[model samples]
Target: MKKINQLYTGFALAMMLLMSSCVKDLDQQPYVQETSASVYAKAENYKRVMAKVYASLAVGGQEKGDGNADLSGRAANAYLRIYFNLQELPTDEAVYTWGGGDALNPLQFITWNTTDEWSAAMYYRILYTVGLCNEFLRNATDEKISKFTPAEVAEIQAQRNDVRFIRAVAWSHALDLFGIPPFVTETDPVGAFFPRQIKRPDLFSYVESELKEVAAALPSRTQAEAGRASKGAAFALLAKLYLNAEVYTGTGKYSECVAAANEVIAQGYTLEDTYSKLFNADNDKRTNEIIFAIQQDGMNTTSWGGTTYLVCGPIVGSMNATERGVQSGWSSIRTTPQFVSLFTDVTGTTDRRARFHTDGQSLDINDVTLQTDGYGLTKFTNKTDAGGNGSNYAEGLVDTDFPMLRLADVYLMYAEAVLRGGTGGTATEALGYVNQIRTRAYAGSNAGNISQGDLNLNFILAERGRELFWECTRRTDLIRFGRFTGNTYLWQWKGGVKAGTTVNPRYNVFPIPAADRAANPNLEQNKDY
Candidate 1:
């Protein structure tokens, strides 16, 4: 079933190519104006629609075009920050300081609202991708186009399922950030407008049902479907949904989390042995830790342009000395001192917390001095000096695959869920799961011996922060624990707020983009917007 989804998704890519060539005015007109009958004439045309779906996943934050500013500038700005700081700002540990014109700046203000333009852009992009998937499924069975082999047909259906999986992800993101969103499915007209904001609980139920229906039908792992959605990916996402079910839908699904996680575990996946190796550039496809990833190639005809690394790499002061020079445009997305202090010496001897710092050599964090303010994140350091210009900012591309799901996350989630009594299990088992990750980081197995009281939700949240920093999971984790709107740190937008004290429910969900409301007057702004 998972393979079927991938095949369908691949077929959608094929559809994209066909549609691109056949639709004379598609490029000239808005997507809503395009008709399904004109576009879905052939199996190949359905593939093109899938291509658009696949392409949408690639449009995350990246480095700005200019080479000398902060990496977190306008280019890296998006819904991601809303997730990242959702927890840190309201508390004392981190704040969104006012000054920069970027979206993050306004987060400091009590009256800060998500701009309509930003909200509309994300909503538009998500719907456009969903529309492509819907169109492909509608016309995929047409006999007028060249018929597909039984195997090909199965693959096409599977691909449609994968698109739904992707759609679920987009919806989940929106629901988490915006609380209630207009649920738009394929059955709705192309230009149909939805005015009501569905309640958060209702939206959560919808997503949960959608994932449950499709995940089971997904195919098992196979090399032919590598880099595409797999059964394991579906299960992993389902686990995530369950892990947060209580927060999203007012229902606890700990057993559901265990079931979903166990499905992946039973499929022969295991945590990678090393912490750093998971993101090491050379590992690529070899890292069994990854369950799903967006495949990226630096060469011609198969490139993703290294957006993740470009956006997260060090700036002018912290570049690696032996390799790429300083990145002037790099936005120093400094790791919070709180997060940086989590690492302890494995030998219980010298503090290696400095490993997160970058010396003033090049723009990469790996090459920085150990004593530097734990500001720069070393996770996505760019090593290649392959740019035409001598500066690190000019580095063309690095082939780091953006991980969507990996085994370590599964293990950790299972442990946390079990500890929370969701799986009706003991904390010892949960501790063991956490130790597996810690041991890999060379931090020893002390984490395995933690007591029940020490295994509280706060502890689990901190553990996740230490293990999953910059993996784009922190914001979600914080929000789930009710800490996203409470914690405080230096340079926080709401200055002087105490760490782990303040509370702002509005911060839990994003405002509907103003542009969306403008375009569709029926759309309502989230409360307090």
Candidate 2:
């Protein structure tokens, strides 16, 4: 089920969408058009609208290439693009060299304020998707289901459960990034209105509860479509939430983390034999490993963000753009030295996972603006495993699916939980899981294998970098390990200094966009913002 073929790119969806309002930050009050009641009167329109919700994750709007977007700004404002910026840019995993004093540029230096556009875009993108989900969920009630045949109703029920999982993912991101974000549900009215802010602890419970229900009710891992949420996705998300339960709820839930990880493992999701193929243009075929992904089609769902950014963002002056499956390179993003040092051999002679391009580039980044400063990362590309370009490679768009949750991440999370004294899994099991990942990274060899004694928290952090750097888990992993802020761990230009300096602790959580607070007085700013 390549759901990318089903993405709703119709003008009707754009006309019927009721963009969710969280205040001035979102600018969503103006998008209300046709009544959702009339739109859903057609039996097929339900799927059309649901496809729009999923498209919100991949493309910016109904049309292609940032024209008539669901949210404002360029294609860079898409959900996954801003999500990558907020998650990876502020950490040591990546560095964007096009910083002409823009909001997205300050992230590498950790100098962003409350008025940053990228953060506001992320806030609006999540809520806008939530708003669409709320509308779909509100209409998928018992009375509404009576109108459809039994088969349609059964499908609707499953899709509605999937919508809940999508919403829970948004709220979990809020719990992780923003201390308190405005909250709403299907019970709320369908149009413009102020929403009350949810406390971090309360949001955690809501996300947890929703995921639990979805984990049990949704289709099994094998039963789900390619891009749709499955039981394994819910369990994987639950495992992630539980892994960070200590940061979100002020209580260590390592035992719960291990339990959720166990459930994910029991779902029969396996690891891909080759690690590089997991992110290539043909990644959709690796559904056995990828639990859930935001699907992208170069021709159908054309956007400048999503995997398009992943493929082109790191392509530089001397690198082969055609080999990267794009016509040209953006020459914008590169890897940090600390990240390059994670692998003993930056040239990737031994570990196939170390896909770095250091031809004309230096491992050290003395000048952040120079493309030759940092090592160019070739981890993501629009090229297929069979040596062909993606569907939309001609337009510089990409067909790579962004794996939101995968078995490798869960394997690491389970190992981390076990090391933190979780009871459900043992050190021996954790060590085996870690070695499974290591052996794959080392290409079926035991060269990177580690002992049970080596399966500590610090090694887990470094191994996570080696396995999952550009996948957008670095900042969160650092936060869980108490190294995101302060003098603990410093990489290139951590605090706008070449030698790396400590940042204030308040930088941990992004400040609630100031415009949102002004529009809704009920919302309070995060501390010291």
Candidate 3:
């Protein structure tokens, strides 16, 4: 149930929703015959289109390989891969060794500009997803619902809320990653004038309001599909948005963050006893802990993105492919020395979260471009919790579903919000939540926990790194603490320097892709791009 089988055969329908990708010229479009009249004549088409919306983030295209590349950067075009590259590669937690002709090179060194291809690709990809959601919502209106049976109408209404949740997700990422993104909604006509940009504060308000509205209509965690968004999923996203409210809108909403997190926490999700099991190929079985995950299946949702790259990218040097149960070692991604040092002992640590492979690698990374310069991470693998190979895994592809949000993260958020002066929780309770995470990480070791005094902003930040490494939250966490672009904290190879240097604060938000800005004059670039 967790795996989203590419349920639709009509790839053309998926491409039809991408208004930006339909034309050769950014500002121009060739007339097409497949209008909403033909595509949306039946109500069942709603779910098929919804599949495309989720698939946009799961696989790269209609087919696995080079042909029918749905978006640009083909292999790297998948939403989570580009999102991971932009979010994780540029941060201190991870680095890619591919320096030559790599589109992601700019991100790794923080030398990105408006012309960076990955940035543009991700921007288009997210907007394309939002467009599909808009298209679905537009077709499922009250006038259209009048024709369906009452039961069908009820199902369509529930599906409409699900589409709204997906839209809220894409918009939230856009707001977080691109500052104010070009705005569009179901109310906007399909082929009218171009959409104008919305500022960050306004975008934040939209995401907040949308989540609140949809959360009420969404199914409970138990009732929803494993990959589908639900009340828990909405609560998780709301918690994350409120956690970063200050960064997005210049307002502190830590209290709201705590309340939202508590909402999810009370929704009956518990931590997995084994920390390493969360990233195994069979992670879809760990649905109790995972609120929402981008579904991936080796046999069904095959792509170079998703957990396939996530598992293979970090396996380098002497990391045996057979031992990891994957076909090959991509050997692309590895941890920075700064990140490795966060653990008490890299080699022999009781912390199960310290999942680094040090067999032929050095702990210190003298050069960021060399693969073996830093320790490889074994956090994500094609093996299962029971040390068995994953079913249907082959040729570097995997069945690992990437956890978008988990219960542990919600717990951490609650504690952090409390420390930040949120009203709903006490420091003692916050410390208890932090200890729950540590108890899992430490396993059976005597490393019991810390007192209330140790639960400060700095400790919470470091704890987040330890727990959520490689999960694409590092950049946002660092930004909220004012450590992303300043001298307050430094990682290797930041700001294009071997020894990290302070970068311009303008980099806090990525520049809008040059092509997008050139196409829509109404879209203004972020300052100092």
Error of 2 at 144 (Å): 2.6
What tens digits encode model 3's per-residue C-alpha lDDT throughout 380-432?
A: 88887778876665556787888999999998999999988899877888888
Among all candidates shown, the one with the greatest TM-score = 2
Model 3 root-mean-square deviation: 4.2
Worst 10-residue lDDT window, candidate 1: 62-71
lDDT of 1 by residue, 63-120 (tens): 1221221123232332333333443333323222222444544443333465633444
- Candidate 2: C-alpha lDDT: 0.84
The alpha-carbon lDDT assigned to residue 441 of candidate 1 equals 60
Arranged by TM-score with the best first, the candidates are 2, 3, 1
Clashing pairs in 2: none
Q: In candidate 1, residue 498 scores what lDDT? A: 23
lDDT by residue (tens digit), candidate 2, 1-529? 2565664455335444433322446645665445667676766667777777777788776667655677665224678988999899888889888876555676778888888778777888888888888988999987887888888888788779888888888888888889699999999876678899999999999999999999999888888875778899999999999999999989989999999999989988888999989999999999878888888888777778888989999998599999988899989999889989899998776888899998999888998889989999999889899989998766888989899899999999999999998988999999999899989888899998988777899999999999998888998999999999998999998999877899998888888888889999889998888
Residue 503 in candidate 2, Cα distance off native in Å: 0.7
**C-alpha RMSD by candidate, in order:** 6.8, 4.4, 4.2
For model 1 the TM-score comes to 0.77
Worst 10-residue lDDT window for candidate 3 reads: 12-21
Best by lDDT: 2
